[model samples]
Target chain A: MGSITLRAVSKTFGSTTVLRDINLVIQEGEFVVVVGPSGCGKSTLLRIVAGLERATSGHTLLDDRPIDNMPPYHRNIGMVFQNYALYPHMTVYDNLAFGMSAHKVPKKEIQTRIGQVAELLELQTLLRAKPSTLSGGQRQRVAVGRALVRQPHAFLMDEPLSNLDALLRERMRVELRRLHERLRIPTLYVTHDQTEAMTLADKLAVMRAGEVLQVGTPKTVYQQPATVFVAKFLGSPPMNLVRVESRTRGAMNPVGGAEEAVAMPAWIQEGWEDATDENGTIWCGFRPESVMKRRGPGGLEIPITVEAVETLGPRCHVHGSWGGQPITLTAEDGAMWTRGAVMRVAVPWDQVHWFHGRTERRIEPRPARLETLETGGAG
Target chain B: MSNRLSRLVPATAETPVRSAKPSHPEKHWRLPTDWREMLIGYGLILPSFWVFLVFYYGPAFFLFYIAFFHWNIFASQSQFVGLHNFAILFHQPVFWLSLFNTAYYVVLVVPVTTLLALALALLLRESAGLRGGGVTRALVFLPHVTPVVATSIIWVWIFNPNFGLANALLRVLHLPALNWLASTHWALPSVMIYTVWHSVGLYTVLFLAGLATIPRHVLEAAQMDGARGWLAFRRILWPLMGPITFFVVILVSINTMQTFSQIYTLTGGPHGGAGGPAFATTTDSLLIYQTAFLYLHFSLASAMSVVLFGLILALTLVQKLIADRFVFYR
Candidate 1:
């Protein structure tokens, strides 16, 4: 099985810990995206799984066998780096043939593998060209082909498309997804782009501060992030966090005490603890999309003064000040890429996420969401 | 406007009284022609030219001028013998032998030293980013900065007849210790060892700097594409370091051609022997000095100096022309 599992993995560089206690299980043929902001250890985690880095503690398992001490070559894992890492000295064919050659595959089999990979990546015509001569997209494809030629246990990509131009990155994302669909191989992809994490991942892990904050399907992580950090990290105009004290019957409750009754998230009703959280005091998070442009049932409409409008093609972003703080919400299917406009935005209460901000734990849930966080709060 | 100008300019009004400066183009800026700028330019250049005229061209041109006649450092009894001095110098077997020996010295030293230097440079350059690269680099470059005479003395000890460092090490290894400085068979090789040691440092530093110029991603990418140690080195590092290596080769070759301080200090004293035991260490410059200073064959030595200069020039130019085809710069 190509299923990969990381158990309590931690990595440190000198005194600074880069990744900490990462525990994850990727099922066979699962497509996973380890998404985080830059320097959040998403790439480091991917590198560790690829055996490019040695985990300082704990272990990684492929089919339940620990691989803490494995070298990259012995791990039978193919990695595509952000820069593509295509050998400038070698032709595309040679680049693709290299890994297989190192594995001591027969020359004929190597040729067959290269041919198949090239055909798959549509790089057959450029085999004789050196990496320096190829365009960015072509070079990236060759790098992928180099990995693909091995047909190893899994593929590890470290922000592999971040170097490409915007249009090309979008195009390659679809191509990569299509390839994954066809190959159906377990792949661990790292990217800081939430859009990429949402579009390409069969399962997504949102990481921050060298820790996995939440792991789930795209819909789950987007709607019900486990922590304030995840909530702030994963969205485009990231989820707005409003510090609201508990209120009972529209009156402020005693300081640091639970309110009698109020409309709250489903997970908050479950218990005092989940593995990631035991604290009762929580930070509420709601995405811009969840809080929509129109009024809907059980949705809270927050009043604000629009600061600016960012029109990104089919949709518009209404950035404004809510309760004397900046809050940006997506205007649903509106035509306003214009600047300086005011509007009231509504947040569907069922779609809001609540979490222990201190422990970075999911204390609230979204039962109405399409999917839920990895603890299986909702499906 | 007219009232104020009328009083002072009344005298000059007949000659068209305005500012007596030419002004035509609005777009043009004024260029400074002050003597200070000229003085500053002259000041900037004076030191180099002064040294060049006095030390470099002065000796080179004066050597030729003095070669036509004969001039001794101490004697007023100078004589002009036309080309007869060169004729005599050419006829003398010892002078010719010294020249031939010097040529042999260059032939033996240049290719061998260049290959060894380039090989060492490549190794040092490749491992420059690895652990202990700094220590290794410092050790390699130590000989270049150390005084040549000091190193020559150290090598002299190494090349001693029986109890020297080289023979002692050989004895420790249970290998036969051949007489180094004394044996005509080993004398040239002994000097070459010192020369290689002295020159490898400069080449290594040049190559390490050259290695820095090579983009690291290119090498890393090469590694990713499965180009391992040797292939990465031969194809990528070799091609990239060519210009620096060639420049160093030319420089070290010129330095080797005129290698004098060590030879003079180690082998040119009283009973210091003339170019080792049997003229094996008699390089071109040492031979030139023996003729000019010791024997006062100034004209002949000057002629020999011209030949050596020509040899150095020719070799350097040849290396440059050949290296041009292979040097990669980007």
Candidate 2:
């Protein structure tokens, strides 16, 4: 029922900066997840919001009220730590009631709230069980229930599912999504797992090297990554990035010469001259799933020399080199691919994302082209 | 062979894998190797066993044996006494005084030392990773490591009625200084103070170790839940520290009950020599020592030693019983 905003937030420990100039907002009833690899300061950003850590240079606001200097307990924020951090000596019921008791909630209300949470989390039978006796998934529910019973302004979860086994994590992920749908509490979740972020977040922020690179819907961040890092970070078998050696107006030469030069769509070519002005370095990226085995009109064809194939039940990843630059493309698992075999895959021009080499920032297709691109462009 | 195969497979398996034996080479080698391993373990323990038997159990059993006999160090033949030592001990007002004094010392030292150690531990835990923390910890523990006898002698001089640190501090605070070790009322209390100061360090460090085993996130979680300071400590920290507190209490109790050298060194000065002007500071352990070495009443001393042993064992077992109901392992 409250919004959390971080304005120009930065954190430094001695000389090394762990977070820098970060700006993010979690709207009322929205689920915002900050996702990145470990040591990227994603957790630090979440800690700043929870008031566990103070921002060095910026303010955190809960409902636009400055909360940077507020003690964590005074902030009335409920955070589920990565390890659950359940009071080992307390039973599930006591753990759920602890915060309410701390806040001096009435005894009757505490009982009612705990009963509701326990039932909601399917933890009725586990009310008397201590955390040590609970399984990982059960403990996670108790942790979530502890936060839920507080009825805080917002919720913060730090990789809460990371400790659970894969099957349990998936189940809990779905459960968490369903719970969010039902309650609509503003939540700021931080995780290193991309799949979890993509599935759970209403809005996603991708961070790298102490800075947020992109903040948008998961689909938009995946489709229109702001930087080369984002393009490479968000997907499984990530986007294949090939360096552009040179380009002349409408035609661009990719570094690998095994294939002929690819024809640049007019929209892409419009920004090439202005975007690649620095050191004239450019990167051509296309998602692995974007590569079709059959050619489409205006699609660039590249022959991939297959070196290894990984069969993943329904689909397979074909890892290979194109002109000495490594590329991975997915194919139906039934397809046979031997080592050193050459296969041709076509990537439609619209699927190609261009990036400037020096800045590594994505070169957006012009506004005029964006509409046509969204509607499935004609060659 | 079937039993072995069944042990390897699930109980409800439709078909047991008959190929289990060849897959596990350890099954064939386990018996002889286990024998050899046990032999190595016993070999490693043999030297300590020899020392304990010669220096500990042998004397203990000899003490029990001679408790029934009035043995003299100078005489070859000694008279047998059946329950005579116990009869005399129960009637002796000095023996009752020593027991009462020992009880008083344990009561004073155990709880006070525990609370002080816990407070110091909490302070140290807060200051951990701060500058001078290591130096503070080492300074606190320094007294425990110093020879008890040496420190006790220094303490004797410090308790001097006219010109000592104890009286000097009293005077600085504008309070009158009284006879410390020399006074019957003040003698035991002074020794208790010294005992706590000397031993609180070790218990504090024990507490620090217990606190270290707790996860940092648990406390942070408590903070987020609006539990801070005293509430967090009472609900989270104290509950978690149950086992160690139990251990420290038992250790301090046993140690306080058996206290000897400090009393011998501190109180053994001009006025009455050792057990005070009128046996004011005489504890059970000191009484046993005096009876055996000073008065040469070995049988009577052995009887007292048995009582002390019985007291310590009974106290430890009672503590264990109480702790089992309260302590949480995780």
Candidate 3:
């Protein structure tokens, strides 16, 4: 009953299309976080599901019933706004009770629900206090409490913790996850913060330019990004992407400038074993954490000149240029790497991601069986 | 003496002098550096204070002083009348009629103007995103900027009983035409209609400004809470608007109780000469003018002025008390 589905949804404001065709499904009791940069239509998509914005074309189904035509209140879904939007005139208890009272829930039931939500959110002592008198964290709790009191079929949060300080945002991120677990209500949360998207989502959706680029579990999306944009967006210090020309069966050269060839690891070579010709130019990507300083010949090695180093607690980021291309690699003991120093870094073939330069999409090798069938059909 | 001298003279780097004066255990007496700033602040306000003394407060005090005297401009000697003027005002039926008429006018105009202005402001706000909204707002506010007397004279024609626009509209609707402004029953009501029309625009503008200050998300949250339309207005908007609504009520009440020009100009001429049709439109302010200038009973007018001032002060204080208890400033 808690499942929500959006099918072929698109929205436009005047001449500008804010959201292209978007399809998503939130299974019952699942926590889905849509992550993207600003102006990416993530908030707009959440509003569409919350009934605050109407889709230009498509249907929104709740529990398999079309609910797009229903008003926000009739949909019985709770939404926490970015600003909290707590009534300044009302006390915390009254703010929590307002929605229930609007729905004409019995007075005793409203009281019971408010009591439970207050205890759950640790707002017992703050119920009679007005929102103006409460601190930001307290106000945030009251906002969540207000949404929680409805015992809603689903919850929608739009950057709820973006206003809080970093320390408090981290704590509230954990609290929000725990609250979702306890309530077990299907929730769709939207934020631009990568850490929140990575930690809080049962399923993550990465979006850009009015379209969802990829959706999967956090691990899968991080490990196997569907596009170059997804790969570049999800990780910190971001993934290093360099364009290269495949001139040999098991080696690649930096696209236009450097003449040095890089050896392809065994797994990639085995996947391309049946190919008659090398695929032209493609994008090679590897996470900063996957790059290791090496003096050996097993993996792809590129000589780089270090420009700067950033210390991040247990590790450091070495920013450098390899074959005229800027790259960053995470390393232990930042003291060992100095500015203007030249070093060799290597990445294993499995850790390397391949994307077509023209399409900017990941290039997965065709299975040998399928390759043979295509060859047979051509003959 | 040497310590005082050293304190007076500026010390250079080569002669950095330390005070040899013993520190007092008791309070020190010295002029503060900001004393000149305080003087300049007072000097800046002196002109405005002088103007208030000459125009507003001075006249009000003079009127209070004269309320106890039988003063005449031409007579060389004047006699102290004490409470006699007040006693005479109480016994006069015209004074009581004027008080009743003022009360009636206030009771009717204040609530009606406030409600109508709020409704119109809501409509304008809803239509603000649509085309021609700016023009419509200007049209609504245009009446407020036009001279009141000029508009009242024009309204005089609109409310004319015979061959007038008011009756013409009634006839077009197939409704029976009745004498307005000429009839005693309709004279006061006709003046009220004119007052509300002329002043509702200003209140509407104030309300529009108040509506603008409210955050849009609060209303959206209410909509999500199943409170729409009337329910939303009552529970969300009205309570949030407490401060502005209180201000509008007080302002409208004070203005309505003192209505004079529209009543004087609209109901003037052949039919009993303003506050006319057998004194149906004579409010307290109009009666005060008639008592002072027409009959040259300056003492009686002064006494009436004191009573009016007292009522306005008391009403404002009561509203302030209520506001402190109920109005939410933020």
Give the top-scoring candidate (lDDT). 2
User: Candidate 3 — which residues are off by over 4 angstroms?
Assistant: A243-282, A295-298, A367-379, B1-33, B39-49, B75-80, B172-174, B269-272
Better of 2 and 3 by TM-score: 2
**Would you estimate the TM-scores of all the predictions?**
0.80, 0.91, 0.88
Query: How well is each residue in B206-268 modelled by candidate 1, as lDDT tens digits?
Result: 766777887765565444444556766776667767777788778777887888887776665
Better of 1 and 3 by DockQ: 3
- What lDDT is reached at residue A286 by model 1? 73
lDDT of 1 by residue, A59-135 (tens): 89988888887655467777788888766656788777766676678999998888888889999899998777889
Q: Give stretches of model 1 more than 4 Å off.
A: A1-3, A25-28, A62-67, A74-76, A97-130, A150-152, A247-281, A311-313, A332-345, A365-379, B1-43, B61-137, B212-232, B235-244, B270-272
Q: CA lDDT of B201 in candidate 2?
A: 96
Residue B1 accuracy (lDDT) in model 3: 38
How do the residues B1-330 of candidate 3 rate in per-residue lDDT, one tens digit apiece?
Answer: 353434335863323432444467256665553674466567868999999999999988989988999888679878898999999999999899999889888889999999999999999999998999999999988888888789988988898778789999999999988778888888898888888889999999999999999998888888777788787898899999898899899999888877887887887833437787898888899999888877899999999999998988898899899999999888
DockQ class, candidate 2 = medium
lDDT of 3 by residue, A261-352 (tens): 87876545565433222555668889999898875446678877899999989999999987778899999989988899888788876678
Q: In candidate 2, what are the lDDT values of residues A175-255, reduced to their tens digit?
A: 999999999999999999999999999999999989999899999999888889999988998999988755456776656
Q: CA lDDT, every prediction?
A: 0.74, 0.88, 0.86
Clashing pairs in 1: A291-A347
The digit string of per-residue lDDT tens for model 2 on B187-210 reads 999999999989999999999999
